[model samples]
Target chain A: MMTTVKQAEKFAAKTLTEDGLIDFFSGIGLIAIGYFWLIDNSALSAIMPLAIVNFWKISRKRISEPRIGKVTLARGKKGNVRAGRTILIIVSLTLAVGVILWLKGGAGDVQGTWYYPLFAAGPSLFIATITFFSAIYLKCPRFFGYAGWIIAAAGITIWLGEGPARALMISGVPFLVVGLWTFAKFLSAHPKADQ
Target chain B: MALKPEALDKVIHEPARLLIMTHLYVVTDADFVYLKRATGMTAGNLSTHLTKLEGAGFVKITKSFQGKKPKTTCKLTAKGRKAFEEYRKNILEVLKT
Candidate 1:
């Protein structure tokens, strides 16, 4: 009986990890970073969240439905609100810190010093932190691995002076590839239900 | 603190139905296919269990069509959730003793 309960719990946790939605969103966010850097266009990058949402919805309709079927999570409404607040807090903190540092020494004074590295590292660290929290909340260990990669990539980009935008793009590649792989695997695992 | 077996909910006592209820407790609603995959049960078995749950007013099943395809979703009713909670409490109490 205990074993059965454990298995049920395991299954519940696995549901969070099974869909690959996180990977897909992460991939899109990273690619947006890359595009932002390559084109130096903030406008293009600004659309990333929307793009991720649309892509996820479309993919769920096309790819996920045929395979794993639809699952409307019970806590989805509350989860969305929490996720939004978290992102807002992270973005606000990043901006506030950047503004403070810039005011202290001006852009020129801060550009070649520790401030530059901190600025470059801030967003990635935020992503890593969020992923870590998600890993804990979802009971999915794989997210920790993703967080590690984001942290490592952030550190490397700081050392290389690649800027946060470029670093995000660079770090995002693995997530994008992994997301695609996971999507493909999911497609194969469950075929479309017969009409 | 001996467990009165009668305290346990007979409807939720079955392992398969217990698993199904547990899944519903966590999520707002889940489709038939999702439940089947999660519980590793055949369509017929799952359907049968769902019928029992629905009959007991423990779960609400909704049927609709998405495009040309049919969709069936299940959710735990308020009574069902309360009962599950009570069931868990009783089980825990029994285990503690």
Candidate 2:
């Protein structure tokens, strides 16, 4: 009985994020955001995750549900997933606002200070925190891996004197690679269901 | 007084159907393919069990079309949910004994 309960819970969690399409799109979005930030285009970087999230919803319906099938989880479960997403959006927007303010000279300058490196590392760390929570709440192990990778990449980039742009770009690679591979395997495993 | 052993829900007693019921109980509803994958049940076996479940009025299977492809989704009925909960209670009681 307990085993069955656990299996059902696992299924619910898997339904939250199974195909990896979100991660795939997330990776591309991160890379784009990194590029935009590198060019000092804060607006584009700010909007990228939101755009990717919208695209992921459409893509899941078009690409994933048709292949693997669909499951509408319980209301509480759905809410939990939504909450995780909302937290991510909040973090991204907060980072964007901070960056924009710093650019506008609203925050006092300290470009040469140790805090500058911390500033560059901030977004990635925030992303890592969000992903870590997602991993635990969504019960998706891949997000945990993503959280670790993002943190490591952020640290490396900062240590090497690179900015958050580099951190974001490097952080995106795993998601893209794994998402594509999972999508391919999913397509193969579940062909388009015949009428 | 000892509880009757047969008081346990026979419909959900079978392993496969129990698996299906447990899955449905956890969600609002699920499609045929998702259930198949989750349970690791063969098409024929799943179909047969679903038929039995439908006959028992424990599961409601809906057939529709998503674009050109046929879609079959299953939802546990109110009666089914009650039955499943009762079954769980019974099993827990038995285990306690």
- Evaluate model 1: give its lDDT: 0.77
A89-173, model 2: which lDDT tens digit per residue? Answer: 8777766766765766656663565466667877897888788887876678989999999999998988887888899999999
lDDT tens digits, residues B1-97, model 1? 4777889999998988988988888777888877887777889999999999999999999999888888888899999999888998898887783
* Residue B31 lDDT, candidate 1, scale 0-100: 84
In model 2, how well does chain A match by TM-score? Answer: 0.80
Candidate 2: stretches off by over 4 Å:
A1-3, A15-18, A75-110, A113-118, B42-48, B51-57
Where does candidate 2 clash, by residue pair?
none
Top candidate, metric TM-score: 1
Compared with the real two-chain complex, what DockQ does model 2 have?
Answer: 0.51
- Tens-digit lDDT track of model 1 for A43-153: 878787688878778867776655666665544346765875687587669857975887777555455876787777887877777777777667678788888998899
Query: Which of the CAPRI classes, incorrect, acceptable, medium or high, describes model 1?
Result: medium
Q: What DockQ do you compute for every candidate structure? A: 0.50, 0.51
